[model samples]
Target: GYTVHTVLEYNYVLAVEVNGSVVGYVQTEQVFDSAREEVAQRINYAGAGEESWTVEPSYQIAVGEQVLNENQMADAILESSSSEIQSATGLYVNGELVAVTTEGDRLRQELDNMLAPYQNPDDPNLTVAFNKEVRCEDSIYFTSTLVPVDEIIGKLHGEEQGAVYYTIQSGDTPWTVAGSFGISVDELQAQNPDYDFNSNSGFPVGSQLTISQAMPYLQVKRTLVSTYQETIPYETEEQQDSTLPMGTVQVVQEGAEGLAEITQQQVFYGDSSTPSETTIIDRVVVQEPVKRIVAMGQYVPAENIAYLSDGSTLIWPVPAYRGISRWMLGAGGKIHGGVDIRANYGTEILASASGQVTVAGYHWSYGNYVVINHGNGYQTLYAHASSLAVRAGQTVAQGQVIAYVGSTGKSSGNHCHFEIRLNGARQQPRDFFPNK
Candidate 1:
């Protein structure tokens, strides 16, 4: 079907068809030593006494319906020669040959091995066939597929977004550099595909590392500020004790402002004199009708006290304890039973515990008192109250407002007398309030 003409110095052998057409050619010298020698010897014998053998140059061939151009044909011939060389010597380029060695015969052999099956046209099992239909005049035309060059180029370049640049500085490592800019090591590698951090010379100093900027979501918050005012009554105790003339002083009628009488006395002598040693005896309140009154002993300084035990001490039932006639319990005499919380009229009184209101009405010496029996063997009394909001047997929670502070019965001034009794025994109120 075909004849081969071996060329000596050119290192090529030509395959000629029966019609004297040169089908293809291979490089014989680039193949194996034995094949090259045999080809050279045969050529010498065949052309003995002749100037040269007439060898047709290579021509294009139609493999299937697709035509292989000159360059593709030449590549195919080179690959075939490399394959033959590999099969003969069990090595690409036949080891000592120089022609195929310059053209990377080992790499060609690898590619040939990879593409060998697709190169064969005669073997049905080795070839892959694809049919494409074309429209003709009242007929269907089928031809082999021709892939466009642009499509091949497009396939070479894959789908991916581009990269950004970040400069490297001192104390920078691959991990730290990527982490500071919020990028992954894999992404960094993809951005600069040629980066070789392992090699010292690959990424030089002052070089930029390409990365992608990271984006995140956020939220907003609002704040505000304001201010206001209120009026509260103020009272201070006189520092000293003194007596003033108690005769009825003339009150000023309408449109008359009275003048205040001034008097001072030495209550403490020499080095013993202090600010508390003397007290104000009389004071005047200037108004539409001016009035004046005599003041006696200064009120005691109010100090917050705590009981040493586990309960609160109660306030005495009387506003002032100077008039206590007898003691109800033992031989303790007519001593004051409870402390008085001096509050202005209508100050709210709170319940000490969660309990039911046992007594909320009036009593002889106790006045308009309310007694609450707490369930845990504890009871509290609020006496000298102006009014009670809770009724008898009504349930009350702890810290609930029950009444207002007032001087209702045998009391001298407006105050709340609070008392706490545990299992019918009086206990000090300061024990429960450690900070007071």
Candidate 2:
């Protein structure tokens, strides 16, 4: 058996002593099968004072295959194992071993879910098979765990295409949701067949919206035929009656919607989650539409009907008003829905046209305001007032003093925020004041 020993070069030696007296020295490279026996023999031959050895300062030594110092041993270990080891997952497709996920098996579930939506119950040939294998993972201290589902599905579906879908939330618009998905508003509208951005109030809350980077999955062609009953809405016809006063309408008959049968064949393509194409094969209208009729009267006394001319007209609402403070849109071109006219504080706010006061009181953004209904389906509004001279349902003539303009609620300064409405829908105020 070998024994532990301190090593030295030609310039350095081990001092030997016996009986507390220095005697001779031994080189560090000199190996001994037995250190005790070797040291005793040295002491006896040199007549040392004590059987002991002294190592000089700054001496280096090795214990077996390792350095004696902790730091030196650590440095040796690091230098031997400096190369990085990678941990990857072996990917298996359709039970046959395929490529390896450069990252790891953590993304297995994500890929599985993306393929789930494309599965077809009618077609048994379409299927998805995927799995992961972990091997030689000893050296990797940190591993990548996430792989975007879109990226994985893109590979299987052919080409680098992806999809993003989300549920509609409160305060979400087509523009906003499209932006969130990194697509244009027009593209989003095209993806959905039933949603009409211009006419719709907005997407109903919790409805799912899909945005795809490319066509999804294999093309699945199928045909469907069905027939259903549809509602044929009633039509209204007006008959003039001289006996009834003008602006009066009477329903002579109560009309109802008629039923109609419709049968058609359609060709559908792609998965149920998001169909790629649909074409009508045939269509037939089994029942004809019915018409509805209504009667209107004409005969108005001149004193009762107010008119500036044959058509409706509007006047400046604020007396002693300055220029237009703000247009019908805000700073960033966002819809403000009304115009703000600069006026003196508490200046008399006059009616823009002869009308009945439909609304008069405090409003959220308009503050103390008044809305006048001008019998001809036209209306005018005066907002941000200090006091009101008219109450709801009160009729007033054109240019009549209705309220005083002031900064009451949600106003920056003294101004009259004016708006013109037709049948409860806001219209351009300038359109009614063509000569302004």
Candidate 3:
């Protein structure tokens, strides 16, 4: 309708037009369009009538052949890209995912409700857990479905659950067995009440042990008290009694055994027989021990008395020429009243000369013996005798058997204790004997 012509502006060629007889540029090549063309294009794209076109600019603008504004273009570009989003609940067992659900919080709440009855009410920190591995975790994925909490709970408590059994071996303790089964020692002990752990031979070999990892996954602790009673041996007590004969011993009172009681306290976890902790609570003697009593004799008799002098010579105490075992004075300067003649245990003791038995009884250091009175200033003494053949007031001649040689009283060995007494005083017997 209107004539258009080209005009040169610097390097761009412009299209000119005459509108209402006013010359105006219609467009500049690769640069911009005239105001009339821009407004008209906007009006056409918005489908506005001439009346609205005069009132205001359109909400949309056209760029090239596409009909998109700045805000609309940005929205379209953003919509073209995509990302993965996962929102669901997951059931993880032993760190492995086993199931998933859309409603994670709901499933967890339901599981808690189901497990509430089995939870340890007394322990606020304790919670119910599945016998097997099971837990909920948040996961990322595209899509997932919700699983019923009841179904999962059924699987936890149902017969499909696994069980563990252990055969007791030598040197195996409940603690070790439970550890192998992935359980606590107390748990192992609580289930096997019949097994005796007090003895050294614990849980006999080849015995079968049941490990409890069952439903209502809760651990129970128990206190086990063990009592040990044993006999304490009584000690022998030797009591020296001077009244008893030197060669004799008698038991005054019999010794009795005593009893010792030991009490122990132990703590165990769950059905376990093994104790996690053990302590000795009490150890005492229930009955005191009665010591054995033995009585010994210590009595000395007076030497024989001689008044008149007699021409009686001494003879050998034993038949053979037995050498003297000890002298009157011992190695430590201890005074020995009689000579020890080396003789066998039951050797005969002969009377040195014609004499009468003056004293016959147990002597403190003389053991068992008899003293002979020769009726002279000289008197021979025969001590440390096993048996007294002649009694007091009995007469005996020379070479007559009066007693037997023995290791009695304080005698160290079997020997004849011989000595010559002058007026009841000790003297060397060898001095009186021609060949002692």
lDDT of all predictions: 0.46, 0.58, 0.60
Segments in model 2 whose C-alpha atoms lie over 4 Å from true places: 1-310, 330-334, 434-436
**Candidate 3 lDDT by residue in tens digits, 1-436:** 2333322223332332222121222123322222334333322332423324231211222122323333232222222211222445567656444555676776678666655654556764343454445677553322323456566655544554346677898788877788888888777777777776656665889998879644343233455567889898989876767665333458999999999998887776545568778898898999988998877533212221112335435656665436777667644324787677888777777776778888877888888877888877667777888888888999987666788888778788888788777777787554444344
Q: Model 1: which ten-residue window has the lowest total lDDT?
A: 134-143
Worst 10 residues of 3 by lDDT: 55-64
Q: How high a TM-score does candidate 1 get?
A: 0.25
lDDT winner between 2 and 3, please give it. Answer: 3
Higher-scoring candidate on TM-score, 1 or 3: 3
Estimate TM-scores for all models.
Answer: 0.25, 0.28, 0.28
Greater lDDT among 1 and 2 belongs to: 2
Off by over 4 Å in 1: 1-334
